[model samples]
Target chain A: MSIEHRDDTGDRFGMWLFLYTEVILFSGLFILYAMALAKFPQQYAEASHKLNIYFGSINTIVLLTSSLTIALAVSAIQMGRVKHCLNLCWVTVALAILFLVNKYFEWSAEISHGIYPGSEQLAEMGEGVTSFFNLYYFTAGLHGLHVLIGASLIGVVAVLTAKGKVTSDRYTLLENSALYWHLVDLVWIFLFPLYYLIL
Target chain B: MTEHKHEPVPYRTFIQIWLALLVLTGVTIAVSRVNLGALNVWVALAVASVKSSLVIFYFMHLRQESRLFKICLLVMLVILAIFIGMTFIDVLYR
Candidate 1:
C-alpha cells in the first residue's frame, strides 16, 4: 500500500526535532514556575486570584478561534482553495491582534497597581509574594516572547500567501508555521489556568 | 493531486469544539468557586489536561496523521510524562 519517500520523511522528522527543541525551551520556564508555585503557595495563590479572569477568558477564546481559522487555512491550502486560505490566514492574524490588545489592557492594569516584578506592591507583600511576582513576570515574559514570535510568523504566512508562494501542493511551510502557532496557543491554554484561575 | 469534488470545511465540528471549550472554561471557573482546598488544584489540572488533549486531537488534526508520526509522538509523550511525574514527586513529596 503506502510508499514512503525518504525526502518527505526526512523533512518531517527534522521538523519534529525542531519542535522538540521548542518543547525543551518552554520546559525550562515550566520548571521555574513549578518551583516558585511550590515555594510560595499562598503568595502564588493570591497573585493568581488578582489576575483578571474576564480578560484571561476572553483571550483564551480569541486564541482558540484563531487556532480554528489557521487550521481552516491549512485545510484550504490542502484543498487548492488559495483565496480561501489567504483570507483565513488574515482572519487568524486579526484574531492575534485582538489577543495582544487584550493582553495589553490586562498587563497595563496589573502594572498600574505596581504588581510587576520587584515593584512596591510586591515589596509590601514580603518575601514570598515578591518571589511569586518574580516568577510570574519571568514565566509570563517568556511566554509573551513566544506570542510575539508567533504573531511575526502569522505576518510571514500572510506575506507568503499574497506573493503566491504557498500552494496546495507546496504548503509544508505554511502547515508547519500554523502548527507552531497552534502550539503557542496551546501553551497559553495551560498557562491561563496555572497562573490565573486555580487557587 | 487527486481529483475530487470540493467539500465544505467541517463548520459543525468547529462549533462543537468551541462549545466544548466554553463549557470547560465555565466548569473550571465554577470549580474554582467551590474551593475543594488542595484537591481543587488537581481538579483544575485534570480539566485542563482534557481540554488540551481535545485541542491536540481535533484542532491540531493529530488523530488524522500517519501512524508513524502518531507513534513517535506517543513515545515522546510517555517520556515527558515520566519526566514530569518524577519531578513533581520530588518537589511535592520529597
Candidate 2:
C-alpha cells in the first residue's frame, strides 16, 4: 500500500473551507441576534448597558493579543525558531485562559445579580430583555467553547512541535492552528461591540 | 514534489497590527459612549468590521493566501450579507 503524502496548500484550502462553514453557522446566530435587537431595540439597549464595557474591552484586547501571539508562533516556526514558537504558543494559550477567567467573573457577577437566563430576575424582565440575555449567553457561550477547543488544539500542536513532528518543513498543523485562533478572535471582534458597546 | 515555502511575516508587522486592533477597540468603546442615535450601531459595526479585516488580512495572512481562498471568503461574506438582508426585510417590516 502506498502512503499518500501531505499537501500543504490542499490542507490549508480544506481548513479555509471548514472555516467558511463555521462562519455561516455563526452568521445564523448573528441573524437571530439582529432580529431580536430589531424587535426589542429599547430592551437591547438597556440590557447592553448592563454589560461592563471595561471587562469586555479587556477581553477584546486579550483575544487580539492572543491572535498576534499565535500568528507570531506560526512565523517563528516558519523561520525554524522552535523555542520561540513554543513560547508563543504557550503565551497564546495563557491569554485564552485569561479571557475565559475574565468571562467567568463577568458572568458570575451578572448571575449573582440574577441576570442569567431562566433566572427569576430575567423572568421578571420583558421579552426583549429575556431575548437579549438569551442571545448574549448563546453567542458568547459558543465563542467561549470555541476558544477552549482552539486552545486545546494549539496545545496539541505545541506538543507535536516540541516533539519535532511539526517542523519548519511541515508546519501546516501550526499554521492551521493559528488560523483557528484568529477566527476565534474575529468572532469576538463582532461579539464585543454587539453585546458590550452597541447600547 | 517541491515543498511550498512561505515568507515569514516580520514580528514588527504583527505588533503593529495588534496595536491597531487595540486602538480600534478603544475607539469603538469611546464611540459607543456617545449618543449617535441609530447611527451608533452602524458605527460600532463599522469599527468591528475594520478590526476583523485587519485580523484576516494580516494576522491570518489572508492577503498572502491564494486567490481561490480570497474568492471563497468573498462568496461566503456575500451569502451572509444576503441572509442578513433578507432577514432584515422581514424583521423591519413585520
Q: In terms of TM-score, which candidate is strongest?
A: 2
Please provide, for model 1 over A1-199, each residue's C-alpha lDDT reduced to its tens digit, 9 standing for 90 to 100.
9984435344555666676677667766777677777787887888778788899889888888888888888778877888888898888888888888888888899899998976876799877778766766776677777777877887897788778887776676777777788778777777877777756
Best by lDDT: 2
Q: Which tens-of-lDDT digit does each residue in B1-94 have in candidate 1?
A: 3322223347567668768977897788788778777788787788888887777777666666567767877777787777777888888887
* Interface Cα root-mean-square deviation for all models: 3.2, 1.0
* TM-score between model 2 and native: 0.97
Question: Poorest 10 consecutive residues of model 2 chain B by lDDT?
Answer: B1-10
Model 1 chain B lDDT-worst window of ten: B1-10
Off by over 4 Å in 1: A1-9, B1-9, B92-94
What is the Å distance of residue A184 in model 1 from its true position? 0.7
Q: Candidate 1 lDDT (Cα, whole model)?
A: 0.76
Evaluate all candidate structures by whole-model CA lDDT and list the values in order. Answer: 0.76, 0.92
- Best-performing candidate as measured by DockQ: 2
C-alpha lDDT of residue A27 in model 1: 68
The DockQ for candidate 2, computed on C-alphas, is 0.84
Task: Give the lDDT of residue B85 in candidate 2.
Answer: 95
Model 2 spans with C-alpha error above 4 angstroms: A1-4, B1-3
Docking quality of model 1: it rates as: acceptable
